[model samples]
Target: MRTLFSKCLVAPALFASTLASAEVKLPFTLDWKFEGPSAPYFLAVDNGHFADQDLSVEISAGQGSLDAIPKVATGAYPVGFADINSLVKFLDQNPGAPVTAVMMIYDKPPFAVVGRKSQGISTVADLEGSVLGAPPPDGAWAQFPVFAKENGLDMSKIKVEPVGFPTREPMLAEGKVDSVTGFSFSSYLNLVRLGVPEEDLTTLLMADYGLALYGNAIIVNTDYAEKNPEVITGFLTAVAEGVKDAAADPMAGAQAVIDRNPAGNVELEAWRLKLALQDSILTDYVMANGLGDIDVERFEKALEQIAVTYEFKGEPSVSTIFTDAYLPASELLMMK
Candidate 1:
């Protein structure tokens, strides 16, 4: 009888050892630097969500939303976070790239035209005659034409200054540019930190103004996804759990980011995380339907909107762009 009990204990330990040995290393790339919006991914690592799925995830920060598509397409990184709209353009240009979005993260994209009210720019129409600072590779800048077209703004009248990402916010703060294109939560909070009053800022979120675009999503190298189907599902399941936990305790999520970024302020990051949760992540559609999935109708409409500005080399299809086959059952994806 003693031997039987000993065998039971040893069996559990052996299983654990085997599971640990079977863990796969997945390198993940993010759409941007370590900030409040990126806390959930870090939380996934810190909270053992990835470990629970037998994945060892190493996260690296990216320069912009467009940065990770090629990295994942080339199979350099198995998975990455990036703008879905940019992915559409990339596949259209590259034609048969091995990368596609697997999960929808930002239901309501944070793209916006952020301007100072004091600079006589309180509305979208105010942008017509203003000097707009836009980074060439920015996802928001890429979508600006669609926003302008929907709002009936004449682009020819607007003075566009091509600014680098580092100088984007500062140029607006220093009055060099009246407005800039960027993610709403990121630009708004950055300007606040730079001594710009909250009231002085006018953030015209494109979604609020008739843009039907979705935002960043979890993208994967299709070749990698095909070879390891279970790994893709497990990675997404862990990501869903991480997003849920981060939404539940935003301060904890912010701490995870701060731990990774020693220079990050916990208070600021917490505030930023909350803004993302409210503005982009936990939208009405997402809260009702759960995370990591998209409404087919909405996604199709978004594609039509993307076509407004970009001249596609070939027709884009929903199936080629995203697939929910690797997502866990819907029950596990519920945030609230």
Candidate 2:
């Protein structure tokens, strides 16, 4: 069954770009295969929002948030995507990681425990003692155990099987494992494409488990943000406009993603990203509070969860991770 971002929900998109028509340079990276959920970034570039911001943008593909975060911090790219879990860990260990968020692309974290509904999996409790799957447990997605524990799950009972990424989707469908880890944009939709009905799938995302993992937060170095607030605002303006356009028309947005997928399940996963976003993205809070809404309360809550899970001593300071000075809520004005 199609979710909110399906064909039926798409309306005519508004493409008013709130930027000057000139070339400005902004380099960026994508954390995974370019498809579906990556739409808004591509849409803004395609629709000339970046140009309207007087910016010329370049997009590159990195393996995942793990790779992108360091690159952004080191200036390999001025902007990149990383979920909240990584940010929490980085700030805990190295107070000088030098990154702050621009916007949350996905209002709900997409990391999820995916399994066959046929396996009698209804909740995290049902998967007790079950072996869920993944490739490497060393990277950003490693937060799943913390996610599991946050939900009152006994991590010792739930085993993690390191099945390589290539076989991740089929293994779950074939019942090769009890459950497997994947993003809603990547795995859940691929399952539907492989003939599993949406109703037959069970997903327990950390977001639903009270862990509130923030995915694909557009990030820039703190130093860059301090000096080039206008550039940051310009990027935010382009991104926010693209998000609105996608929410208004997903097929066109999915097409933006499909154009970038070199291989893999192109349209199938694109459709899923569309569904996933509409199910819980483009929040009223985001639109109402203005583009790139950074909820300070939510950020602190995530830090609190991280401190509990990782045993950090105390609250990390606001200066270590976030700075609102880059984005004035006043300048977040969309092109009228």
**Candidate with maximal TM-score:** 1
On residues 1-336, what C-alpha lDDT tens digit does candidate 2 reach at each position? 777676444432322233333356889887776777777888899998887888888888888777888888887788887765676677677667777676666666777788776886778787777777787853324667667667778877867788877788778877778777877556777676677778988877767788655656788987777788899888878877777677677778888877776564555645766766654465555556555556777877776666655776546775566555555355453322
Backbone clashes for every candidate come to 0, 5
Cα lDDT computed for each candidate against the true fold = 0.92, 0.71
Model 2: lDDT equals 0.71
lDDT of 1 by residue, 1-336 (tens): 579889998999999899889999999999788988888888889999999999999999998766799999999999999999999999999989999999999999999899999998999989988999999977789889889889999999999999998999999999999999998999999999999999999999999998899999999999999999999999999999888888889899999999999998999999999989999999998889999888889888899999887888998999999999899999998888
Q: Which numbered prediction scores highest in lDDT against the true structure? A: 1
Candidate 2 local Cα displacement, residue 210, angstroms: 1.5
Candidate 1: give the clashing pairs: none
In model 2, what are the clashing residue pairs, if there are any? 19-52, 20-52, 24-54, 24-55, 24-56
